[model samples]
Target: MAIADQSGRTVFITGASAGVGRQTAIVLAAAGATVVLGCRDLAKGAAVRDHIRAVTPAARVSVVALDLASLESIREAAKQVCAEHDRIDVLINNAGVMRPPRSTTADGFELQFGTNHLGHFALTGLLLERLLPVAGSRVVTVASPAHRQGRIDFDDLQSERRYRRSAAYAQSKLANLLFTYELQRRLAVGGATTVALAAHPGGARTELNRNLPFLFRGASWGLARPITHPVEIGALSILYAAVDPGALGGEYYGPDGLFEFKGQPTRLESTPRSHDAATQRRLWEVSQQLTDVRYDALAKSR
Candidate 1:
């Protein structure tokens, strides 16, 4: 069932300037939740905030600058958030980059692996202490169906040796699932009320492809999948995971309709590798080592 009461709920979403995060913000605001839209560009973020305000009229909305490539920027964003809001009910790790070729982040990690997995990893870990005590707090993360083809090559997690764009992107997405599932397992063992759940948008059309070369962008924009699903539908799984009472912690969800690339929220199947306890644990350990942030320990400090 849907979450019926959200008058005072606060949702902090990364990449809120476009696609799933943007649409989810609008839907959540209408449901009476305060929405914080995190973006890398302050000006673009403001434009999204305006659109939200225009639609919800009196929508509790704010935009903050957040660049996932830099840890300093992530820390600064968290500080700004803590200073502005005492608590956040929901944290959506929705911002991600796909298939960028041969580039490293500010922290010297591969772009997709760094931005998609490590950035969100550090961000969530930084915010967990603040969220865990809130009782109903949930961290909703986004993964991808592309993860089905992923295998974590721990020896080359940064793709320093083999930098095929898709390989790196898929590996990072796989890391996201591993982190989400492991987070839930850890939280359960510790008896924390916080829940770690994930949702994937099956090729919903979003601006995530805007950075691609013109031909690819044009081809994607003209396609029937990402550009096919209405942004509203693209936001459904995220909205469902964020508020739906049935969305159990540690569970992975996706579009329930045909092939799981487009449809309503449902318990779509993940690859067997995603469910492998051994691999998941390995990913958790590697992620901890790479990001150098332990959310579990942080939760304990509180």
Candidate 2:
């Protein structure tokens, strides 16, 4: 429960309508941070705000419409955020979808890759200026252990050649880490004070797995009761990355327990492949080309 006090900070969280995003928003709001819930569902977002307010009567909370499945929504959300807030202390790319039937985003990219990776890539690029001006600002992107199973198929990045739901989802999560490390590298090279970090919930009990195979979903639900903790616990890794004074850019954190399935947030290591510089660079370039949103600070600094 003891975490950094973000008393006067501004935190913008994506997918705050429910799950870990919602839990993180509440925690930050309770700590007196101005919490902006970026959600695609206004009604669900309102309910989350009400919950936060009920917990902390003086909570500073607001909601902006955001749909990670659409590049247009990301732009509008970023604009609304910048128009309203002078600075952003932290931006949490916490919203995501799990293994779903193969689909494409509004931008016509693979659903998981578009929403989970490209959406955030564009959002962060568009909002980098707002973060750069604020000392110690951080951007935390959520990855998953499933990332270990991911392989970036540049030839078929959208799974147009072969589509396996689980593999696609894993690839997207891997993209998150690649994006985080690449962003951190750019931020440091650009002489920017802001940092980019990544975290994983370590198998938290959330609705992200609702799209799994029905049999697996039913069986996992029963087994997960003992292995998976609640959203709050899963959210600690994110809060730690967002506010932990010792947290470094490009570092990743997750649970510290058995197989990293459940435990308190702790510094965790990702797969060796996730740290490949060449792949990271390639992914960054492709992401820029796909999303069409470039990080200006890096270019200006270069």
Candidate 3:
């Protein structure tokens, strides 16, 4: 059976130009949702939009330029989205950078931390008003298994003292889960019906591996069946998070296959560190400071 037709619903997805983000957009668009494709590259975004229209002639898809690395870009994108639509039923924080080399964002935060976590954090904060009035809305963040190996080094958040690509990526993924849970708690406290949840692609084959070492990349591809699944299968978890009526606030979904790498979407548990209340609160504060965005509606609801 197909997921229910999402006619009249609007979903905004970051990084929709490629990979699981792109696949998820296609699925929702085919189901009759108005899919807003958020991409750093507008040309690529347009191509994806055109492709969706071609496949699903009735699909409503729009391409918006979004660069998560820059707070200014995020603000501009949010403004445009809010102006174009009255309500956003779902916001998928799917754009992310994996184990890339040490790099800084336009705002000087580490690339993975800035793009993967802070970017979505700010975007959601900016769009909270549009979401709050809508009933049963959701914010679904995409995290990773790498979070299991992550440690939130509060003192060296930027990895200014010591930089390891994998460690920094893991930390950012962990931050994603922490953000999801913390946001859900705040939403509940504020009495808002806008729920927050998370999902992971679970080792799906996507262009996100462009940053991996050549040998490691080769190994991942060569061992594809044993390690990775197609992006479509991977995107199922995100679809579940976005549209599952039974899904609850603060819950997480990922693959149920071996090592949670490849299988149907299923409820999954995150690391103990991801569930730490103090860390989630602290990270929320730091993210606000770095992004200069605040969830003012949440405060008003309290």
Candidate 4:
């Protein structure tokens, strides 16, 4: 059932302390990939490394602190990773915050959009050079079924207006899909082997939902109980996108069961809006302006 061993691969996964990212890291390590765990908290990252070692004594796991709320921290982390490794075979943008009390990132961007989208956007651009030079690197962004109901408000990408917590989150996740799609387009034009793809967990029980207010937490749990799959199972779709054979340049995947909230990894349709190349390109430009991270820099030499 697992894909063939990825013995020589190096994987960088964010939010590796717990939940889907943690489980996905462990699974990748078990598949013989050397995994770099990116965490907002160093101690938590170390604990994950130790736990992986306990279970798979020979697991190659390293921890690095990456605070998605701070662009400087993300830059430093990406720089350090590039300095240490010759190439990263896969980059999983799995770390993200959900519905935190209305707040802003270090750069003053709204938390959900900043941490979930812009942070990863900047990091990806920073590391694009390293990944593209490698033979077949892939970037996998974890999105959500909630994106189905999202509309990117160009007027207020940060939700500076009409900020409902849920809406902000939807916008951020929608941004994730847009970023993934645009990256794939650029990778193709640049003639790079590195691929960019998107996948969503479809409401598996992960800590991503932990930020919800207590009442909403209980309510969500009750509402999705029977249909919600285990976090570990939820990780399969991401892992599949990360290492499965014949992975495409721009594809979206989710659970193969009811409402895509449960069961095995399988192809799932993205909302028609998510497929709009023009909107994706516009969002890409806005992201560059906001984060001051540019993918075109990767194009300059090529």
* Top-lDDT candidate index: 3
State the lDDT at 30 in candidate 4.
Answer: 82
Residue 193 of model 3 has an lDDT of 96
Q: Which ten residues in a row are the worst by lDDT in model 1?
A: 218-227
Clashes of 1: 3
Sorted on TM-score, highest at the top, how do the candidates line up? 3, 2, 4, 1
TM-score of each predicted structure versus truth: 0.93, 0.96, 0.97, 0.96
The sequence of per-residue lDDT tens digits that candidate 4 reaches over residues 66-127 is: 99999999999998999888889999999888878888999999999999999999999988
Which tens-of-lDDT digit does each residue in 1-302 have in candidate 3?
15788999999999999999999999999999999999999999999999999999999999989999999999999999999999999999999998887899999999999999999999999988878888999999999999999999999999999999999999999999999999999999888999999999998888888777675464255545576788889999999999988778899999999899899899999988999999999999989888989888678767
Give the 10-residue window scoring lowest on summed lDDT in candidate 2. 214-223
What tens-digit string does per-residue lDDT give for candidate 1 at 153-194? Answer: 988988988888888888888888988888888888888888
**What is the lDDT, from 0 to 100, of the residue 72 in candidate 4?**
93
lDDT of 2 by residue, 77-183 (tens): 99999999989999999999888888899999999999999999999998887888899999999999899999999999999999999999999999999999989
Instruction: Please state every model's RMSD to the true fold in angstroms.
Output: 2.2, 1.5, 1.3, 1.7
